[model samples]
Target: MLVQMFDLLATRRDFFVGLLLEHVQISLVSIAIAIVVGGIAGILISEFQRAAKPTLAVVNFLYTIPSISMLGFLIPFSGVGDATAVIALTIYALLPMVRATHTGITNVDPSILEAARGMGGTRMQTLLRVRLPLALPVIMSGIRNMVVMTIALAGIASFIGAGGLGVAIYRGITTNNAAMTMAGSLLIAVLALVVDFVLGFVEKRMGMRSKAAKRTNRRLAVGALVACGVAAACAVVPGMVAGAPATINVATKPMTEQYIMGNMLKDLIEQDTNLKVKVTQGVGSGTSNIEPAMESGDFDLYPEYTGTGWAMVLKKGGTYSEDEFGQLKAGYRKKGLGWVGMYGFGNTYGIAVRSDVAKRYGIKTYSDLAKVTDRLKLGAEADFFERADGYDALCKAYGMRFGSTMQLDIGLKYDALEQGSVDALIIFTTDGKLSHANATVLKDDKGFFPSYECGNVVRTKVLEQHPELRAVLKKLDGTITESDMARMNYQVEEKGEDPEDVAREYLRAKGLLK
Candidate 1:
């Protein structure tokens, strides 16, 4: 697994390098911002004893909000990118820094403070020279805690389309590529360790009272500041490396199949044109998030489902005509978006059961499973429980209720089923694990599912800005069949191939690329 992970890293060196720098950039910026805000807040609260409790309470409350939820709340104002990521991480880094600053300052000995004052020191001098230096160790400890936490939480930033190492981790999970996941995780762990060790060493050295030690600490602080400046430059430089090239940003929902499609489109566009294609994969909140970003011009294109665009985006329910494509295009036109073309796959949601359970219950269709639902336990992703076309509506459509339901991570659903923790699951039509787990997909016999034909959807303004984009994207129209998509997903999830590699091979095999 380690060898495979290294091999994967070597093959995608440029991409991984960008992600690494991005991760560092997000962490550093967030920590710097937190230090400024948290450090000041800590000082004020420490000095004003009456205000300490309530102020600390507010900071604590902010920290207690779930990471993803906090990020979601920030997206409306910040959109999807490094700014949003930095803001969210900065908030998360605050509590530790604030607490540490307050603790360190308050713990200073009273006699030492009085001595500084008696020596003609003003209140400010007493704080800067006496209390602050004495409190240096504790304050440094808080900064250390904030730095480590920020690095780890920066991974979650990728979910909101802020480029970072988390992109690799989430992609690995969606595709069931253990090597990819491991590679990302290991790198993040190493980064956190390095940051902690370096800061910790500095903190210890600063705690020494010797005059020579103070000189050494000042030199180290200068060196650290320089290092931070360089890191900030590295984080922002890569985004501009291509030098004003006509760029198209692609967005993708958080799933294996979406990864394959998004990368495929990115590869095709980059291979054929001078235009730079920046793909932001595994965007959370699905279409709800992606659509708004498009409207705000944050993304140029993404693979969107017809059913999602129709029912969810257009708010037109109970659909279908053979002419659905025309209707979808017309609807999106009003929103400054265009349906580029279909990729020739219909990836609707499905109810699936373990083969043994399928056989025992004679469950071959959704309705058949409904009869035995009271005896079955369902496991699905958290998103499935909340989607408009998700669990609640599905149950209503089939008139079925499971004995119990478990909301498992998308990557773990198959494991849950195989382990008999869940008798059935919500599954994507193209998930590779369906075969690995020996599961049988139940037919949606009553057509409870709307048509979910996959296609490229781009912002119309982006197409107008770069006329060749429409031509570049034409290469993918009707290229991948339904089975082809499933096989591509299988190769990633079950065979542990990278999605980019899988997409490249499929395009070559189809003679779309040499």
Candidate 2:
């Protein structure tokens, strides 16, 4: 337990540094955006005496909405990524800054305004020199609030595939791994505390300078303004250029067959069409990656399971026939996404036992395994821990309980099972390692799991724009099988071959590529 805790902590330290940087980046950008946009809105709203109360009320109401729900609402439009996260945080930060700006500007002393007017200062000059100076502290305070809230909110961005400390926490919680959960939670807390302290120090320094009779140093202020302008220009350059015809954006989950398939498709599409492809991996669990990126128009294509499309992407709940490709296609169409066709394969979930263990226990089927389940240990992936058809549900259906069972990450399950630490594991039917290890897949005599055929999901608009893309993808239909997918997965994941290389080779062998 100690060693496991130490390992988790060490891994968390690495993730913490990355999370801290991401938090800083998102919070700073969001706060900056809030200041400029909210400042303008505040100024405009302040112009009308009747509008001020209503405007402030609206902003306050928006601020009261829970951040997570706000993020979910934004997903269909903004999709999953850093952009959505920043936009959501920016909106959340707007209320405090707007309120601060209005209060600061309105509270300017009438006597001071009269004195400035009598001194022959123009409206612009008086507003800039007197009103701004007096209000700077309050505006800064608003900015401080925005900064703190945004940092906290940014941690949750990982839910939508925006990597941060939240990824660690989400992974830990889903896996039921106490060591990982503690490490992630502790690291995030420390990051938040540190950032808050740093910002507080800056706020204090600014306050001290404001109290002194001296104005803020003009050169320092100008330098900061210039730096911000440069950063803004840098961010805008990417969307300007027209992406190439063969360019494809493949989005997929991290360390899974879908991820590998997405990368492979990128290569196959490029090789067959002579186009460029960019693969974006590490998307989080479920159809979370599919709809968001598709709706936002950020991704060109991605691999998804038919059942995932049926239940999650389509939001339809219940058992369905295994040969329901049409249902999956209909579901995607209804959701404004396009289905390009299957990869001629399905990756089913099943219980796997080491060859030696299966031989020892004479366990060839799930029914046989039930007899010895009380003496065996089971390991499951994070998703399998929580999914309706997962270990808990499976156990209930089987009327048996393992002697000891724990959730393990999909990536680590093979190692754990191979080392004899776990007697059985929940795994994808087509996982390459299962073939490599001579493991036995217990037949689901009861057919507990749903079918998960692999296919490409595209934005409806993208399909309209590039009609040929769907045809290109459709060529792969009925070509790859479960065993073939397993070999390909093993080639990339275990044999250290590039996914693109594996894909190209497969395509070439199939005479799909020149």
Q: Which one is best on lDDT?
A: 1
On the 0 to 100 scale, the lDDT of residue 138 in model 1 is 88
- What is the lDDT of every predicted structure here? 0.85, 0.73
Candidates' TM-scores? Answer: 0.94, 0.63
Summarize candidate 1's per-residue lDDT along 373-443 as a digit string, tens digits: 99999998877787777788899988998999998867778988888999998887877777667689888
For 267-336, candidate 2 gives per-residue lDDT tens digits of 6677666556766555655566556677666777877777766766666655545667777777677767
Query: Native-vs-model 2 lDDT?
Result: 0.73
Q: How close is each model in CA RMSD to the real structure?
A: 2.2, 7.9
Q: Give the lDDT of residue 214 in candidate 2.
A: 35
Q: Where in model 2 is the C-alpha error above 4 Å?
A: 1-27, 31-79, 87-159, 163-217, 241-249, 268-278, 292-300, 311-322, 354-361, 374-377, 385-397, 401-405, 416-422, 436-440, 495-514
lDDT at 506, model 1: 89
